[model samples]
Target: NVMNVIISKKSGQPTTMKLNGVVSTSYSDSAFKFNKDFAISTDTTTFTLEVTWRMIDAEDGSAYDSTDTNSFKIVRSTRVNQPSEGYLDCWERDLFLQFNGKPINAINETMNKLEVVFTTNSDRYKKVSVDITHKSGSTKDSLLALPLSENDSGFSGFFEREVGAPKRDNVLQHSDPDSIILIYRNPDNPLDTIRKAYPFAISKILKFPAASYFDKNADGKVDSIFIEVEGPVDQEDLEKLKSSITLPEPRKFKVNSISVVKGGIALDVTEQSNEIRTYVSPTDKIIVNSGSLPAGGLIEGNIINVQDKVAPVLLSGTFFSDRQDSLQVEFSEPVKHFSSKEPILFSHGGKTYRVELAENGVFSKERFYTSKVISVESGSAITEGDLIWINPAAGIGDTLGIKQLNPENRRVPLKVQEAEYEITVRTVNNPMKPDKPVPPEVVNVFGEKGKKVPPNGVVIVVEPKGEIKNKIKMDEGKVSIYDVVKHLVKKDIEGVFDEGTQKLYFIWDGTNEKKRVVGTGTYNAVIRATTISQKTNNRKTFSQIVPLGVKRK
Candidate 1:
């Protein structure tokens, strides 16, 4: 027999190795080491081999076949070749190369079909790079057969270069509440440039992009696409924004019912024409305002979210200023109390200035517009944010208020103070100033109606323009010397039952709160007696009038 080493065991004898197939066996650690160098080979048979090892911590666990870190690679015969040999464009022509399936271009290891291979390294990356030598000797410049797509079994779609970046959304969501022009950008464009900006004028022309892709081409029927969606928090850069962003508190916006006028938002509601009745929803209530309600109707508040932006201003310097006169407070949001700033500005020129909100003119007793000549002279008052143009001679600091436009609609932020109303007194009779003893009327939350009372005693609740200084009376061709006044003198003056009209009617020859009646006398007079729901505006409005005409007295 050829020379060989055999390790044998005998009964009650120590283990020994026989060398050269003869006696005098000297055991060798070298022979055992050489044995380990070669892989074990067995008779060709359909069988399985398992490798088991104890982990550093976990015990008694049998290792799996895949637990072996050692691996092998099987590359395709025509994976790469110089142009001189032959160009293989099969990978580029077939989409199957991108997929992990049969006839794969590359393999990491040898395995039987349908074999379950466990791996100790849970995290493993298999990457392959193809290098086709284009130039070889005299033959130069060769084309490579590159994969058109790549598929990961874990993900639904394959990663393909030709498909390019994801198609960005073409449909635009309205972002600005006030803007007439909608501005936005294409979602897929790396530059973030606007694909389409719709102006309010061309709403009909713009159509939403077709979303046929959203429909399922898979299964030849409708099916939900297996999409890998991620929340904002799950994004990588989102953590950076967390520290920088300051989220505002959510607030409940109370919607007030709009008061409608006659003739479909008519400029004048007097002619007794077609009426426009206001309808209030369960979540809404009417708030009667002197100004007109919007013609288009109420807009939703949800669309206008919390806005926070900063605009530069001129505190004391003349930087980008029109004059040392006016300014505009560009706020992130439209201010609640606009046109009431203690200091107003010029929208054209950036300038900071102090303003006189009171009638005293920095020293007058009256406040706001009342101090201006409009309250006393022509009666034209100046509201806050009115451009105050200073005449050089008036004084170096004298700021004369002038009319001007709000720049970019960026008006002054209104200064919010304690809520209160201002009433103006117009006309009263010459003689009975002290005799007019009346309590201020308490208007309900609806700005109308009074309470029901017990019998015997009578009370009158009147809403005058201002405090009645003297008995109210109108002027000649004004609401002055009239039968109503004559009737008042007969009953109130003599304290006798003058006429039936005097008992129920609040007759006035047109007069204002000041008791100074005018030819154009417009006054708000309230009288209380016994009124039913029929007479009132369904528990809304209270009294009626017989035209308080003040004939020339």
Candidate 2:
């Protein structure tokens, strides 16, 4: 008899196998086998066994030959499987095993029990068992043994004890091991048991702090917020963190940047396009969806707070009274350290005046805080086209002690109005007809026709009309009657300025200062009045001259 065993892979190793065995007629019914001491290479899983034998009669040399071939697979060893790494199920808040070669049967709440169903073709093993073990210094300690039961595909069971802790120091602990020892036992031969250990690790979710705040401008309000998290976050984790934030309805925050800060990762939060900077208030609560995070951890909400560090601003200054002597200064917020001695500057008629606040004038009204009605001295009246501004050198401040520094804040252009005046002259008809009516005419002392006047006299009237209700001065020498031919002053008329009527009345009567009628071939009447121009704050003199003709009766 001849027998040959061939290994499927024979590139670099021996393929044929030789066996020492014997077969006899006395044991014709028995099977021939190789010696138990013979060993087969375990480098390959498939092998082929072939046997050839010849039979001959007792008297003849004739022979009958037959060959039989059989193929089979070898069980190398028991293994846990490939891809032994474990993952953190953040949504479930549990450590999940990612096994590629086996199907998961069940997982208990305590995470101590794990059942896996494996498929196999061999029937030599009677039962399967697993040992959950970890290295304790130099020795390996078996935490628990899971004896599996017979199933459709293979054996599956659960461990009786827990495997890992609820939390870990780091998010991923690659150094630690939570491995499984797969064991395959043969009932026929206990010494042929197979056991193998596969090492793996369990990663836990990352946790972050619960409080953050941002005051970029250091103002008394919150400009933005910072949400801290673990560092070295990739783009995928960044998008997840952004979607996990929750704010109140209509109030939204955007992630401006993800940067590595001194402590950890920082998510800078700012306002959206439609939102304002002050959308996040002090002591506001923000919910973080822990399930959406990459790793599993506790849901510690973020608490935001606002801090103030910016000074107040002076907004504008305006004249509150029609007289243009009272200025109202406004501030962006409530201010302090402003008193009656606060030096405020005013620009009027190309001149600068240092003014002070009126008594009890520091008060707030309307929407903004105001230094109400600062009274300018009568001699330095601020009027139309004037300017009033508060300089930073004035040392004004808000309640928080932040000083005002912007010069444009309190600068205001005043629009106070000034008074307007008109002059009219009334002359009598010819002296022969005291009650007769005569036609009125315009006369210019510079050579225009003069208005005919009777010996009785002529009356000059000046009317002041404007927003200003105060009376103007119209004293003697303000209205002068002179002789046009001689170019000499004939008389200085005295006029009465009436505050009630806002008018100045002067009766010339064609007479000289000696109270006598003067010859009036062509007498000139000059009227001069002084007024302050509100635009330039400059004193201006207005003059009007009229020539009169004296008619004989």
Candidate 3:
């Protein structure tokens, strides 16, 4: 706030002047009566100031300087007659949205609440509007939606509060739907010290959906989000964001070598004597290299390349021997065997550690935990509080992955903790005593018992759920076809049946156009018999020949 010290004069006019907090002498014609309500007291006012967010290189939402010329003014009155830097300016309120522990940028950012805070510099406080913009772009396009795991400050947005109306303290949550690594900071927690130092290593990661993003240049398109201090940012004069939001740094391991020894992947092994050395391939495969002479080496398996890690096995004091040298090294504990990244089990306490080879062929652990691979030893040296990790070379075996080892100290387990089962599947199957047909009882009479008409006439009646639909043939001479089967597909059968008694009548207006067939040769009238289903597909047939005698007048 640049105060233009106004003094009492005959005329009432306000003046403007530049302020560097170093004004030596000043005089004005108008007396400036300050609004003591929100103004600084001349005697005991503190020079405390705050901004909603840090300013970006090319943005206008934060503080501005006189260098821009087109800057706004901060309105505040003076109550105390004090020194150079005792001024307060605050006016408009802002809506802050964050995820994990960072502020949201752009519009439509996953907002839990419209956080309100502001600089008193703007004259348009009473009337202010904001846009919550969330947009996602790729590297080729201008990445706006930052990934969750990328650990950094300044340019990454995080969640620090729950997504809803504002409150002093609630369960902090991700304002946007993007995945976030939550690292809580409670000033009064017993584990507060451990939470801040290695925060990324302590907290968990979760992915959600949110529409929050920012367009750094304000081109009407939200391009990215500024990930603020999700946690205590390193006290640096300047801090930067991670290289890429999508790809986070891979974990690391420290061991003498990575190889597929006698045991399978990521397993651990120890030398029996000082007569053998182990050779590990870049692919994480282990092999017994040339050594003096040795047999009977204790081998422990390792399974690495995991999304989550626990600890490795426990090798109850095993020794390594290259055969050439007699000095045998040793380790107190063994590594672990795990099923997958889910952490099924651990050899000892940390025996269930997972391993992930360098995805880009880079990444390593501290040298203190790294073994130099000296003479054959009974065990490797691993210290407490040490974050050990392993890295595999590129283009090695098993598609470029790292070999991890653990302590199998607790006597190879049965792989299962607790078991429970049910008889849902009918554990006992006794030949499935053949299924009985439906309708316990059915009457069976070969032919109809009502009437016996000449088999020469075609029968037409509503279809019944029986095997008598079509297999009834006219029995002309040898070949015969039923009216239903003949008209259904394209087939011609000669001879004629008595359109008798009108039981089955032919509704026709004129005589046959394709000529008549009142013949003497044997005409086949084949009908089909079907199952109770009434489907033509469920039918079979029988044939009978009938001799035609023209009304022997």
Q: Whose lDDT is greatest here? A: 2
Runs in model 1 deviating more than 4 A are 1-342, 346-381, 384-409, 412-479, 483-553
State which candidate, 1 or 2, has the greater lDDT. 2
The parts of candidate 3 lying over 4 Å away from their true place are 1-18, 21-95, 98-128, 131-277, 285-553
For model 2, residues 1-553, the per-residue Cα lDDT tens digits are 1121122111121222223332222211112434444355554355455445444544675656544456665445555233356332211111122233343323222233344444455564466554444322233345334566777655665543333442222111112434444444345543333444445433334345554544354322333555555434444566666666664334355667665555545656554434222223443566666543344222334533333344454345565443434556655566674554554567776677766655555465631433434545567766655766556676766665766555543355655434444445444442313234322321221012233333345556665444354445443226776776556555456555544444555555555666675663666678876554433354446678866665544
lDDT of 2: 0.47
Candidate 3 per-residue lDDT, tens place, 1-553, comes to 1322111111122233223222223322211232234454544444322111122333553432222112233434565344485543333322333433444442222233333222133333233222122111111111122222212221223323232332344333222332222222113321221100101111211111111122222212212322222222221211111211221112111122222212121212122232211122233221222111111111112222222122122122211112211111121112221122211121224443332211222112210111122221123222222232221111111111213332221232221111111111010111111122111111011012222232122221212232222222222212232232233211333222222211111111111234343322222233322221111112223233222211111
Q: Which 10 residues in a row give candidate 2 its minimum summed lDDT? A: 1-10
TM-score comparison, 1 vs 2, better candidate: 2
Query: How close is every model to the real structure, measured as TM-score?
Result: 0.18, 0.37, 0.15
Q: Summarize candidate 1's per-residue lDDT along 1-553 as a digit string, tens digits.
A: 0011111111111223222222332323112111322233342222121212222323654432222122222233434444585433211111112223433332111211211111122122132222111111222221122211223431112222110122333211221121111111213322222111111111111111111101122111111111111211222222222222222121122112212222111011111212111111132221121111121111111211211111211112111111122222222212222223233332223443343333232322211221211111122222333333321222111122211122221233322111122222222232222233222221121122233222111122133243322222211111223243333311221111112111121224233345554453322333222211111111122233323322342
CA RMSD, predictions in order: 27.5, 22.0, 32.7
lDDT of each: 0.22, 0.47, 0.23
- TM-score pick, better of 1 and 3: 1
Arrange candidates, best lDDT first: 2, 3, 1
